[model samples]
Target chain A: DARVTQTPRHKVTEMGQEVTMRCQPILGHNTVFWYRQTMMQGLELLAYFRNRAPLDDSGMPKDRFSAEMPDATLATLKIQPSEPRDSAVYFCASDDEGTYEQYFGPGTRLTVT
Target chain B: AQSVTQPDIHITVSEGASLELRCNYSYGATPYLFWYVQSPGQGLQLLLKYFSGDTLVQGIKGFEAEFKRSQSSFNLRKPSVHWSDAAEYFCAVGEWAAGNKLTFGGGTRVLVKP
Candidate 1:
C-alpha cells in the first residue's frame, strides 16, 4: 500500500542542537503537511506544501524551524538550536490531489534534553 | 479563521457498547470535516471525511459521522465498540478556499473496558 515515510523515527538531542527530519510522500501526491503533536497542544500544523511549493509555514517558529520541499518526493523540517519545549512527535501527511483526505506517516518522535 | 472543538477529553465505554464522540466546528462557510484515529506511537489515520453530498458519512473500522450544519457539529459514532477501538480520536476541519489548511481539535481518548 502507498504510504508516507519519515526518517529517524526517534531522535534525542541535547538543548541547542540542530535536528532535521525527513519525509518522503507517496508518489504523485501533490500536497504535504507537517504537524507537531503533544499532550497539551494535541496536533498543530507547522507547515504545508502543494506541488513542491510551500503554501504556509505560519505555525512554525520562524526563527528556528524551517520546512522545505526539495522535490516531489522529499519534504524536510529542520530545527536549529532545539529546546526541551520542542520535544514532541512530528508527523508528515500528504493529500491526494483533488481530495479532502490525507494520509499520514508514522511520525518522528523527538526528545530534546 | 476556522476551528474545531472536541469537548470530551476522555471517554470510557465497555466492549460491545455503542460509541459516540462529539465534535463541533466554527467557520464562515461550509467546511470540510474529518475524523482521524491515532494509536500510541503511530501517525494519524483518516477514518473519514465530509466535503459535500450526504450529511451522514460512513468510515472505516465501523465508524460513522453525521454533519449538522445548523449546529456546526460533526459527531462520530460506532454501533459496537471493540477493545482494539481504544485510541485517540481527533476532529479536523479544512477550507477549500484556504488551500486546504487543516485545523485539528484537542482530541478525545477512548478507553474500552471489558
Candidate 2:
C-alpha cells in the first residue's frame, strides 16, 4: 500500500532556532500539502504544491515559514526562529489528483520552547 | 472564503450503539467534501469523501457520509460504534477558488464507552 512518509516524528527546539520537517509523498502522486494542527487552530493549511511547484502559501507565515517540493518524491517545511507558539503537529499529505481525498503522513510533532 | 463547521465539539456513545457526527460548510460553486479521522498524536486518515455520483459515500472503517447540497452538510454516520472508534473527526471542504486548499472544521472528539 502507498502512504506518505514523514521524518523526525518528534522535534524539540528552543526559541530562535530553525526547524526543518521532511515528507516523502507516495510515488506517482503529484500534489503535496503541509498542514499545522494545534489546540487553538484545529488544522491550518500552511502550503501546497503541485508537480513540485508551490500552488499556494498564503496561509503560511511568509516571514518565518517556508514549504518546498524539491522533487516529485520529496517535500519540506521549514520554520526559522521558531517560537513557543509555533509548537504543534505538522502533517504532510499527498494525492495523485487534486481532489477531496488526500493521503496523510504520520505527522511530525514539534515543540518550540 | 470557504468555511467548515462541526456543530458538536464532543460526542459520547456506547459500544454497539449508533453514531452520527454533524458537519456543515459554506462555499460558492460546487464543493468537494471529505471526512478525516485522527487518533491521539497521529496524522489524519481519510474516512470518506463526496465528489458527485451518489450523495452517500462509503469509506474505510465502516463509516459513511451523506452530502446534502441544500443544507451544505456532509454528516458522518455509522451503524455501530466500537471502543477503538474513539478519536477526533474532522470535516473538510475542498474548493478550487481557495487555491485547492481544504477548509476544515474545528473537529469532533468521539468518546466510546463499553
Candidate 3:
C-alpha cells in the first residue's frame, strides 16, 4: 500500500507569518501536484511538477506562494507572509506519467489567524 | 479547459436505499473522468475513473459510474447505500493537454441515515 505522505497534518499561524508544507510522493511516482481546498473555492490546483521540474503554477499566487520539488522524493509548498484568506487544507498528490490516476496525501490543514 | 459540475450540494438517503450522484462535464474533446470520495478530515480517495472504451465503470466500495458522451455526463450510482457511505463526493475531468491535470467539481455531500 503505497501512499503520499504530508508533514504537519495541521498548522496554525498568524497573519504575515510563513508556512511551509511538505510532501513525500510514492517512491516510483514522477509527477507531483499541489492543490488547495476551501469551502468557497472547492479544490484549486496550485501547481504541479513532472520529473522534479515545474510544469505549471498558474493557479497559485506567485507573490506569496511557491512550490518546489527539491528532489524526487520531496515536494514542498510555501507561503510567505501568509494571510487569513490562506487558511485552507492543502493537498499533495502524485502519479506516474501517462497514468491518469493521482494518489493523494492526507493533507495539511492550515489555519491563519 | 475542461470543467466538471456536481449539481447536488447535498443529498440525504436512508440505509439500504439506492444512491445516485449527478456529474456533468464540459470539454471540447474526449475527456478523462474520475470520481473521488473524501471522508471527514481525510484525503480524497479514488472511487473510479473512465478513460475510454467502457461507458459503465465499476469502482471500489460498491460504487459505479456511467459515462454518457452525448450528454456530457458521468453519473455515479450505488445499488444500496450504507451508513458508512456518508461522505463528500467529487467529480473531476482530466485535461490531457495540461499534463493530465485534474479539474474538480464543487462536490456533493451525502448523508446516510440509519
lDDT of 1 by residue, A1-113 (tens): 99999999999999999999999999988999999998888899999999998898999999999999988999999999899999999999998778867899999999999
Each prediction's RMSD over C-alphas, in Å, is 0.7, 1.2, 0.6
Superposed model 2: Cα runs more than 4 Å off: A98-100, B97-99
Candidate 1 clashing pairs, residues 3+ apart or interchain: none
Residue A23 miss distance in model 3 (angstroms) = 0.3
User: What CAPRI-style quality would you assign to candidate 3?
Assistant: high
Tell me what fraction of the real C-alpha contacts between chains A and B each candidate also makes: 0.93, 0.82, 0.71
* TM-score per candidate: 0.98, 0.96, 0.99
**Which scores greater on DockQ, model 2 or model 3?**
3
Clash count for candidate 1 is 0
For B1-114, candidate 2 gives per-residue lDDT tens digits of 889999999999999999999999998878889899999878899899887899999999999999999998999999999999999999999886545578899999999999
Candidate with the larger DockQ of 1 and 3: 1
The DockQ of each candidate is 0.88, 0.74, 0.86
Write the candidate numbers in order of decreasing DockQ. Answer: 1, 3, 2
Best by lDDT: 3
lDDT of 2 at A9: 97
